[model samples]
Target: MTLRDEITNCRICAERFAATKTRHQPRPVPWFTPTARVLIAGQAPGLRVHRSGKPFTDASGDRLRDWLGMPPEVFYDLSRVAIVPMAFCFPGYNAQGYDLPPPKVCGQTWHDRVMAELPQVRLRVLVGGAAHRYHLGTKAGVTETVQNWRAYAPDTFVLPHPSWRNTGWLTKNPWFGEEVLPALKARVKEVLND
Candidate 1:
């Protein structure tokens, strides 16, 4: 079977949170097309995405689209953009209402196989610290990685999560909006046009 087929049918880590079964389900939400040039490598699906079976369908998604300077039609078109999170499923929330980190098993089990199917991904947008860690390794923390965007130019762009939780970070980092954003949008358009 193709990697997509295998991923869609996977239940390998379903039992990771058997105790939290009452709160969440293992619905692997991933979007991709083998020919997609731009890949949005984000964290796991949030509660909304897991419920909707769409990778990004909440306020965070709206903000992400804004950052990319793309309309929903173009952003959601898997033929051009691939949305593959570090974890395929929602990893459930904690008592404080924040989502738990995606289980390591998800990456260990599926990333390589799924990535193999996406040979055409030219510009990978790492959408959060976790994604940066996985794709860019321990080269730098999120702040440093994102600050040094030029190092990964044309091939990757590291970004903070677009969730409301990071509103303060965005406010503090004016350069992200002024310098990084324009470059990000241009790179995205360039890759898609390729």
Candidate 2:
């Protein structure tokens, strides 16, 4: 069976998820194809995404798409864009109702394999601290990592999470919008249109 199918049928986190406040089942949302040119490596799915079974189906997605200057048609096109999160399943909420970090086993089991399948990817967009940490192997906090976006630019763009929870962060770091995003949007357009 294909890797996608394997991931779709995965139950590796069933018992672990069954113990969360949500007590939800593992619903892996694997969205990618070999021909994809852009890769969006994000944190785990939010509850809305868990329910939709589609990556970035919430307000965060809307913000991310705007950041990329991409319309939904292009952003959702399997042939051009791949949305792969650190964990395919929602890890469920904590007692405070915040999303738990994605289970590491999911990445440990499938990340390399998924990347191997996408040999054509030319642009990678790392969203949030989890993706930044895993993909860049950086110990810096999200703000610093994103501030140094130039080090990985033209091919990769490290970004803060687009969740509304970070609105204050965005206000504090206006340069991210004025500097990083314009360049990122241009690069995204160039890469996807190439």
Which candidate has the highest lDDT of all?
Answer: 2
- Candidate 2's TM-score reads 0.99
TM-score of each: 0.94, 0.99
**Superposing all C-alpha atoms, what RMSD in Å does each candidate have to the true structure?**
1.4, 0.6
Score each candidate by Cα lDDT.
0.86, 0.95
Point out where model 2 deviates above 4 Å: none
Candidate 2 lDDT = 0.95
**Native-vs-model 1 lDDT?**
0.86
User: What would the per-residue lDDT of candidate 1 be over residues 63-142, giving only the tens digit for each residue?
Assistant: 99999988999999989889989899888877677788988889999887778879899889999988999888855777
Specify the highest-TM-score model's number: 2
TM-score, predicted candidate 1 vs. hidden true structure:
0.94
lDDT of 2 at 157: 97
**What 10-residue stretch in candidate 1 is worst by lDDT?**
16-25
